[model samples]
Target: MAKDFAAMEDSNRSSNPSIHDVSDPARRTVLRGGLGLAVTGLLAPLGAGTLAGCATAGGTAPPLLGFKGVPVSTADAVTVPEGYVTQVIAAWGEPVGVAGAMPAFRFDAGNTAAEQALQLGMHHDGLHYYPLDGSRRGLLVMNHEYTDDGLLHPDGMKTWGAEKVRKAQAAHGVSVIEIEWKDGRWQQVRPSRHARRITAATPCAFSGPAAGHALLRTAADPAGRIVLGTLNNCASGKTPWGTYLTCEENFAFYFKGPERPDAHQRRWGLRPGDPVGYRWHEFDERFDASKHPNEPNRFGWVVEIDPLDPTMTPVKRTALGRAAHEGATVATTKDGRAVVYMGEDARFEYIYKFVTRDRIRPGGFAANHELLDHGTLYVARFDADGSGRWLPLVHGQGPLTAAAGFADQGEVLVKTRQASDLLGATKMDRPEWIDVDRDGWVYCTLTNNSSRGGAGQPAVDAANPRANNTMGHIIRWKEDGDFDGTTFRWNHFVLAGDPANDRADAKGNVNGDAFACPDGLWVDARGVLWIQTDMSTSAMGKGDLARLGNNQMLAADPKSGEVRRFLVGPVGCEITGATATPDGRTMFINIQHPGETPSERSDPDQPRRISNWPDFRADGRPRSATVVIRKADGGVIGT
Candidate 1:
């Protein structure tokens, strides 16, 4: 079904796994009044006669309306742009019985210590395709987020143990599969009633602006409004009405804290590497976060999900605060409200945006599910000449209320980076993903930082215009053109690595060659620019040329800023979390983890699998699938 690629078959190769199902809906309307048009991206990088003058004079090219170039080869499967074909769809414990049975992952039973509403949930990251109202069949809201315990548990998880750690915390959260594409392949529709799985015992609800506050009150919710679980979830963003959201990256590894210090560890901010419970807390001493410091404040923020009502409860919004969150994008604000945009992924941490105060009335999904719930979060400060400013953490701004030391707005939102480093913001290089193109720009991704001191410790600004950024960059902004305007204008368009590790200039690769920690991001709707990498530069044998190569996926050319590479995965993988299939010829990437294989390290039957790979269904157990790239005439891919 991937046909417009021009050529490259045997079902166009494949690889992509980690993101699960929904099985039958095809209602795609996006053509009505052209739905406002939007999504243009165009920028720099073109040559080779400008992609051979768009192709023809025997070079052939003219397929847009869908599918373009960026094939990226490696085998194991999924590599379109020649007439796509990747359909292995759903994975991760193929069962949805409601409380158990995904049991074959074996990462040493460390499912974050279980109770995750019935297990089979581990590492699936950001996904959303909902649809349903007109039928064409849909629903694929995934984001399992963590858990590897060695593989799921057979020789791993037992920091002390408890029912193998409550089936590894019920398997780590979120999953609503019910997909479809009929005979052209793409299955997984078994358990019905929308097939739920919300986890940590699902029952969420906490509107915004940090709900109840008091560091979020513990002993499990205590009036902070029912907060039991929603750890990690990672990279997600959907609401324009359909509802999906999901954010909470790395939730500081479920917390463990016990370096000894009580009075609830001096009232909350407990550090000592932050553990207060780690052994799954013997299965439920509230998971023991040092007798539960509000259970890590109920995990970073941004939840949302309602994929056609999987019993609808998942709603952690909290006016969007809580750090290490990695994703959230939304968009609106011209006057219609509903903003969103976020990042806070650590390193220097910051970059946010909320707005909301309820405005969006586009109608549907119960009015964007109460339009996100009271907003205006701001934070971001940049400048050295590129200009930037979102500021306004509210509560009379300057020093965030409660007399300055921030004892309000939930400690100015759990120390939202010490109130954006005292509202000065700007300290990036690990921002991680935020995407938003169709021309409102807003990209984000900074992903790299060797502790920056070879020169540049917060030096050379202008929205982080590289100074010690070894292999990482992709900033962008616009706002006034809308997209929730908050005073914008920024740059640093594409500076990845390995064009021979850079130094070439005029921009053509050089500084450490090409590819390093760019980290999960996406923009495709024809603006191109994919990126994706993470493992502190891939981390395999640690040679660090972004982890010895093959953790790729780059595109660029947003109208000629031509960056290439397209695909390379396999061997201790990392090229993760991507989304497409509104007819971008189906691309759903997410290879993830893959590490620890040197002949499987001390051998357990040659499991050294750095990637026996998707090798695209020819039989080679390296499976981790989610591929479907098309173009032989269907158009609109990398065009």
Candidate 2:
């Protein structure tokens, strides 16, 4: 999730042992050995073959990276290697091409709420491309993390009304668009039947153990079986049975509560005033916690959508144990059971994993409807000696009994953070996104936690060894046996910062390129680990972070620990979400919140002061869009 809307409060008040507090902290400082195998012969890479329904293929030791690394860039444009080209396919406010109403994006920001519904939502984040005709045509499903009202209306927040609130709400959710390769470039198919927008008002079903719990029940949804919409959708994942996993992060920021919230609300970061000043509660009663107390509980779960089937209602899989989920990455066990690894994007949080009780059947998505529901969710605890344990969050187990505030499985899953707190899960430095490599190793991005080692905050630990960690690092772990195993060994992949910095804490151990705040992550064919960074908008091109330039994407060799800059985004934007064709020739990535000012919002009268990307029209407001990249010589990307 972007820091602009993240929950600012440190809610975990637990005394669970930090990795440094465990035995032998000094021995745990060094990263573990190189990821075992060479990247060349890995069986199933993350993109194309693993995602686009194509037969997985590999060579007998192909080079991990073949392109020349681009230098650090501060320019207000997309920068790629010399042999590659990029095109803007989908952007915020553009028509999603739904039938009967395809509203074009208004450069002056005069689009109404009704028109915004028919168009693409704002701030494209995590996305996946599902092939329809062998990558030539596919459904590009992406998440719209949040909306910037300053750019949504012509006059911005100068005036407030219900209609303006509705427009802002309309711009928060997910977009599924049909895209195809035409005339050597990717394009959105107009009036596409597959085009659909799931917004904050869209109806969604709740499934899994915590579905109908009293905490999730509200006046509008008394049965607790339905939720109005899924907002704050950040990073994403795809299921083995062909479904999209859109995660809800920073949902706590939307609600406006009383002067004093209850324990449950406080635990979830709900406070007295509107910390984010979203002001949605003034227009929509549902956003008022004083009115609809349980409405906030309805969100913060991973939603499963079948992008290929628009008729199907998206389901909020409750069994995944919610906690401001950054994203869910799925891997299968030796016997076909699904193992899901998720990260909660907040300070002092814990990593979670879910293992289904039943094996995935022969049939497609329908046959696995209940697979995610009947799983055992576990939180990770990284020990000082490089070992870790997955503590099960089951009712009546360990400290999660009736005496500890959990009465049943539903309560255990609903209060997941409290449950993990009682089980002594290791406190981490803002776990963001989790992905599994072909070698069965799980990697997660720990975006910097400025509060670490500060006064009245958790001190620097072995797993998170920096005080006021400005530049973040990546943590990787390999399970003892399969993805569903109860134990694993973990280590840091790289500490991200400039090696020449005067401050020792800010100088990272990066091998090739110096980058900060690693966020989005993916492993492509030939086992190249792609990393995307999201430096805070206020800090980019300033202070020690200035030398790093704008937010960029880099390719890393897992075997040799070499990182190379692949692409640098426009000013004030985040380079996130990566996908590629089945042939590995074409690739897709999202540029989010371009022209974002230091305040994280643009001034309506002077919006173009920061950036004017993709379409630099005089009246244009910076728009978040998806960029398509392919090699000029018609060869595999990065090769």
Candidate 3:
């Protein structure tokens, strides 16, 4: 979801300590020596390979990033370095190859509600590639974060009814399509058994400690075990046991509540009305919060889906805790216990981690069906001494007693934000996707927090050094011993901004390319850190962010801190959701909401004014699509 669309208000009222409140010596202690040693120590178990220029286990090393960097691009087009080829594999409104329905995308923006469901959903976000046979054939699963109603309908909100609402709902969720590379290019395997769509109307089951909680029960489902949908699906992750974790982000705005909402509803960003301009509640009674308050609770959870099996129902793992979840990144402990790191993707919110108690069994999905159901969730609190601790959100522990409004573990997980607040967790700058490198270091993207150090807002902190942080930074940490360890040493990997800027705060310490608003993050199989930017449409070509040009993706050598622009997106689009084939030769990236006007809505009469990306048809509307990139010589991506 777009930054302006999500909750921008600072809801946290806790007086917890900030990292800047500590002594100056500790506040500035971003030691590189400590990080170097930690990375070197963990390398052995991860096959002890190379870090860009460092020697590998075989005493021979290859450069991690081998391509020349592309320059800043402002034109309404996709740009990449020389010797690279790009193709549009999947786009919004394209046929998803459902067994009975395979409707082609209408260039006139006239796809019917039934046709939209049969075709690809809108606003492609976090995605993953599950290989079936090496890199030649696989399942490409991606989620549609949200829909722009203006472009969805022919009249653009001039008419409203249940049919329009159904179309929008159908466009919000996950899409799994089997794609195969043959005869020179990748093509969708039509009528694939793996082809499936899990939309907002799809049936989903609840599991874990909070499954049967009273707060989740509604008139439609008295058992509290079943829900109708999963919307606002953002960045995703893949479990070692062959499942996809699609996070529910910015789910609050989907509902409309009474003039005065309860404290619980207000904390999760539910306001008095649809200030974000979502009109779903008008036609769908289930979205009316006053009639069904529990509906929002059913969302905001990490929903797991098995892309290989179309018959398996999607499950919302409640043990991971409810939040405006950004994405879930999974890393296994040395002992094989699964540790999942997550970001809340909201201002003044906290980062979270879940540690499964049992070691991962080896039977894929069968033996580990209940793996995520049994886990202990913890929130992070970064101290100023380059150290951090993961505080357990278990009920009756610390201040999480019954008197504090938490009756049991179920309530604690449902109201994870409040629980984290009471525990004095460190509030981050819109924490987004989190990724762990092969060397066992955890990295998170703290996309900009404009209110930091503002009047009546939280002040500058060591962990978040910039007040009114415009260009977001990436923070990383190495766990003490195990992936599930409670303690860890932390530091800033890079503060993103223009190195030539005159202002002290905006002049970030970037080693190479200048960029802003780091959002999507991925540490590839070979330990290359890929950073994608999501510059707000309002700030893209204006003022301080003008030099950054359009939204772009960059490749960075984590050890050397050398950043280089890899690709730039078309006008008014976000470069997000990246994945690669098993061999690393074929890479996929999604361009979301191209031609998105500054107002965040396109005029129905002139949908192509801003961009017509991928098609460039005179009558075509801007569509969110996946860009497939591969080396001309079929070498590994970014090399």
lDDT of each: 0.56, 0.84, 0.85
- lDDT tens readout by residue for model 2, 25-77: 55544432322221222212322222232232653334567899999888889
Pull out the clashing pairs in model 3.
none
Sorted on lDDT, best first, the list reads: 3, 2, 1
- Give the per-residue lDDT of model 3 (tens digit) for 252-283: 88888768888888888777876466888888
Evaluated against the true structure, the overall lDDT of model 2 is: 0.84
